[model samples]
Target: MSKQSASKSNIPLNPLAFIRKYDELWRRMLFLIGALIVYRLGSHIPVPGMNPERLAQFFDGSQNTFLGMFNMFSGGALERMSIMALGIMPYISASIVVQMMSTVVPSLEALKKEGETGRRTLNKYTRQGTLALAFVQAVGMSAGLISGGLTLTSGLGFYIPAVTSLVAGAMFLMWLGEQITERGIGNGISMLIFASIVSSAPGMITQAFTDNLNLIVILLFAVLGLAVTAAIVYIERAQRRVPVNYAQKQQEGRKVYAQQQSHLPLKLNMAGVIPAIFASSLLLLPATMGQWAGTSANPTTLQSIAQNISLVLQPGSPLYLLLFAVFIIFFCYFYTALMFNPSEVAENLKRSGAYIPGIRPGQQTKRYLDFVLNRLTFIGAIYMTIICLMPMVIQTSFGVSFQLGGASLLIMVVVLMDFIAQVQAHLMTHQYHDQTLIKSSK
Candidate 1:
């Protein structure tokens, strides 16, 4: 082998090493850490007119319901009735709606094909949707606060400020997430969610101690978390490789180049945590409105229907679990379909003179790709469903308060894995630049 190849092989693969060597990577890491700190700090700033004592009491009684899970997502902001109590869910819900619509709506689909300009247009629509949803949710939450006597005053005096604060807070967080995506590592929204989940760790630990959980049980829970995380790492890394062969071509007079071979790596879980995240956000929105209605002193017919729906879908209900699984499965297929087009892939491959082993280049290849993707998506959906349901099942069966549920755990693991992968990619690029510099000097 050449000296260049030998030196390239000798380069270290450790991300930490590159982090120490490269200023840019460390700068991005620091920026991410600083942004998350800002988010945590904002969670402590309560909304005006909130009765802190009553709010605390209210959330204390709601430790096992949908409120509890929602509170966890907000990093205790909801429990405190803070300015950021709404968290990022409004934005997520709006995004889901916009994306799903884009798939079916002719005008939206046209914009989607228009590329970057279309992306900005779609994003503008999503922001508008976020504002609308946030306003409606804020109004409901304000009513609940008044009904529960968690507010300092009644009527429009409290209502106006509360709604304004909540909506503004949600928009601010949306902007912060955008900044993080532009300037930091990993996805901005996922990182924010991850930060929220992790920020609650100290409180969860205190709760465990207060409950007098035994060392053995604590160890068991730790083991369980590790096992789940390990499983996610394994499955997230798994891929199906489809072998492809490129046809040989004549370069000049009598010189024919050798045929080339490569493989397309189709992930076992192409949708990743998106399906679960989307399903959770969609499921929780109704429950939030229902919880607000249930707190009302006098509910209207619409509120009554919402409350009944909430009651039926209360955290551990069989219907909740079944619907969660079904939505996850649907989104797994839906998101996968949105991201990958077998016809497009087949067309590209045919143009490039590449064909999958034993498969024709055009329509047959598309069919084969579709068959493989459907099977993969089916397995992925089932795997995500089982992993997401583990915490609920454990809590219901053993009467244990597993505050860090399976869904949150799965998201954290997946986000961290993706972050690390991005870091490694950065390091690889740096290595390539260094190799080029070395060769140019030689």
Candidate 2:
């Protein structure tokens, strides 16, 4: 109808066009790329004092266990015993601890209610926690390297330097992730993890192909990969829309506006890849401890217990699968609850004079929302469980070495979707700004 609206409607929706027009968006994208390059480079810089041949031999032997998975997440940094061997796990673990504490700790809960300032305080605590964790893990890793004969030099002299290097590297990575979040595109931590997984892809694929060398098997895996990717994209986009009607109100000029209808979009997987990551990290702890115990010449009672626990929890073990699914389901509900508070949402809706159809404004709305969320979480948990277990199942059944399955696949797919969504959002915002400028000029 109007010239402004007509011109706006004619604007191209193409991503390339937006990138060409918006210098800031392109700059952010470049920054993200540069940050990822730095991370990759760090992943290749091995820590000093380790014998490269012995380290490589150790990882080669341990490739099927928890260490392998850690290596995958670190973009081969663990196998290389890189300066970044610790990767971002310490930060993730620290975040999990902080978030879990927020539920039970009154002070933290109060801080949470304080908003941005509180968030900053909590983040400071998380970084401190990360540093602490990095120190402990670095000590363990350095000691392990010495005990396993992977280190060319031994004693406190070697240990001290190695530990310091790992801890410093981890802290640097944490800082890099934060900077990317502030100055680049997409979520920085997730993007880093995504980059790690993707960096390992070419090698994994080549190894798998070499091991199998069956054209049929290769084709089958290719088809399955495509299918899984499609499934992930479809489910990630799926959401349940809860309709709400806002009551009409009179303005300063005494003009009454008509009631407005809108919908709240609740995603199927509100927790995203967090639950899976949490579950995997928890599962890895016992296995890692067990691996360390196995290296001991004389084992104590505690070490024996740890070894038994690790044996029972190998990746393809029945017990491992069961516990993994349970943890995933538990975290799905736990994290979803933390992220989306039904009571808060209901309160906000009520304050805005909005109501879900056939539901009362406050308590009833909360109850209904909780019910919907629980059901959705249940389905999401099942979906995540299946996706995560598929790799193990395929390995056990088909004897295929499909390393890039399950949690890695989910992270890659989800992060990619989020990245694309962020890019599109920037493009749309730029287009809107351009339309406004055009209207003003007219």
Candidate 3:
């Protein structure tokens, strides 16, 4: 027993040793958790017009509609009408506009290739754009208040106060997101969306339960969700490793053809959830009009217009299903084009003395890479479109509503998954260092 105890003691007691016997995931987990907490807290904080008693009545009197869903993505701040109610949406809008402009505006296109300084300049412009958009939307909301989104007991006095408060809140929220990006683990804006989704999960589950879904159906979706998540994980990790060969160097008049190996790894879903996000953001214009039509137009005319919009553009509606599919496909290609250039890649590879096996270098190699990417992108587009659109379409078809958002929920999930993998990679490297030091000490 004494011998056994001694052996056990010698086996190493620090569990971190066993895990750091390769990777330390705890530190990264801690940072991610801490950042998420800050975002979640902000979501519940209320805005200026939050009439305590009336707030519940307002939500109870009406279904939490799409804006309610938007509020959910904002972590309930929208309902409370908090400073963060506008969330970081204005920034996302600004980014989209800037990204599109960078491709079209000749001067902006030149600036893109100028490296870090140009990037910094673009960043400044993006910030300017964010502020501009926030201000405009703030005024719009203020006007909406005057037009009756809110009741002004003080008449014209309300406009100045409301707009000021709202705009200030938006800028504050923007600051918060920037802080998270600087100090937090995952992308700050993405983590905000993650917090919102997580905050709302319990309510959604309880609602489903109370709706009296059959035990089997409840269990089925639960299992299905798990399965789908696992599939996403697998697909995201899948990579096509194209082998590259490098010729050997000659020294002192002796030539040795040395073969080196590297892989041009192409991810199965390379464009990522960005395609879905872009598509969803574009679709929101029509959807926003539908919302406005609901609130402002004459009842009958509103009904017809809303129906028409829904038919053509609403998520899960028939025309919506068609357009959504096409949009996913289009943006998959479009964003891929924006971010990557096979010709540039081939040029760089040739300069570096790397060549794919059985492939000619330069433009020919570029063409081959392009061909491969097209097929991979098609698979990715199909997978994304199906996973994202299915839940909403099926639910809408069955007269059951669920919160299935392309930009908010699905994108958050995918981004979070990627973030976790990156964290784990860092942890693994740290553990490897610790292990090497330990071995040297022993």
Candidate 4:
């Protein structure tokens, strides 16, 4: 054999190493795929008393803008008024509420400090809140459907059974999401959302092609989406590291003691997509009110006020985008405040005998942290605002109804990259010995 080929052959083909790497590479993926299948199955199980024909016609002429697009992110389940129609929104809402409540509610606050045991307690409460919210939402939807005459039109005996079915269906989806998280690769909740985004993709593609959309326009959409996805990946991984100098130490017993110099990695966007989500959910309240009763979607008020709110809440309206950007910015700061505490950090540093250079021990360190955090947050909030609003502005300017799928695509790409990165990390570490073997043979 040639020298190079002989060297390659001498490298170990170790079964144990190969199996470990292979398992690391594929196990999570297997879980994710399996969970996604279950989520899709749940999406199609229709809520009782939903009029398929009416639902179809409503969607056919609808604006399909902000709120409608959000619904699509939950899959057609929202339109179908299926049980999972509520999707993960309620769970997310309950989680936010519980977390917020934990701060205000002393009992809950105590539980939060209990570590693993406290976490389990919080999880239990979150689940309870999810179920309660689902039941209420399902009832509201049931009443809305029946009052709108959508249920009775199908003549299938609507009211009581429909509410029951819808609630049960939503709960089923919740269970499915939890199962996926337990046994899947990606976050189970995120996978459910991801499934919704993907389910809508093929339809959008078909619509674009069959409608004879401008090729340049379609290409622009693709390129913009790719760019946004790349940007999201970059921003998600971005962090500001603050250096810490530990107090120098001498030998103790048989071991040499040395200073540990390190830095804290504070993520640029510590709150992740959570703030955007919370803001969006809160904004939907007005639309839900309008849907509940309407001459205008807003509550009956002074003519100008009602008109103004209706205009603002309208999908793709300038007012809606404005409100969305403001809300995202607000929530970004709010969530950031909730997530990080300068005082706590300073206290930890004091306990650990570490200090930032040129900073005093306690209050000064806290002040410095707050100053740095505020600056980072300013940049982060602006970045978030631009990302959230850019797609809306583009679609509106171009008169393109379907382009904002780019935002959803961006989220999916980032999330998928995170999952892939975790897998690759496991594989690389597991294959280190194999690489060493190959190197030595050379």
lDDT of each: 0.88, 0.86, 0.68, 0.72
**Distance (Å) between predicted and true CA of 151, model 1?**
0.2
- Between 1 and 4, whose TM-score is larger? 1
The 10-residue segment of model 3 with minimum total lDDT is 145-154
> Judged by lDDT against the true structure, how good is candidate 4?
0.72
Q: Point out the higher-scoring one by lDDT: 1 or 3.
A: 1
Candidate 4 lDDT, 101-140, residue by residue in tens: 9889999989988989998899899889988987777666
User: Where does candidate 4 have its weakest 10-residue lDDT segment?
Assistant: 289-298
| Tens-digit lDDT string for candidate 3 (98-170) | 8889999998988899999888778788888888987876665444333334432435566566567666766
lDDT for 434 (candidate 2): 72
- Candidate 1 per-residue lDDT, tens place, 1-442, comes to 7886665554444465545558777788889999999999999988899888888888887887788888888988888888899999999999999989999999999998899999999999999999999999999899878887888998989998999999999999999899888888999999989998998877887787788877787787789889999999999999999999999998889999999999999999999999988888888888977887677667778778877998888777899899999999999999999889899999999999999999999999999999999999999999999999987787677666646778889999999999999899978877887676557545
Candidates' TM-scores? 0.93, 0.93, 0.83, 0.84
Name the weakest run of 10 consecutive residues (lDDT summed) in model 2. 10-19
Error at 137, model 4, angstroms:
1.5
> Candidate 2 on 413-436: residue-level lDDT in tens?
999889999999998988788787
Model 4 lDDT at residue 182? 67
Model 4: how far residue 78 lies from native, Å: 2.4
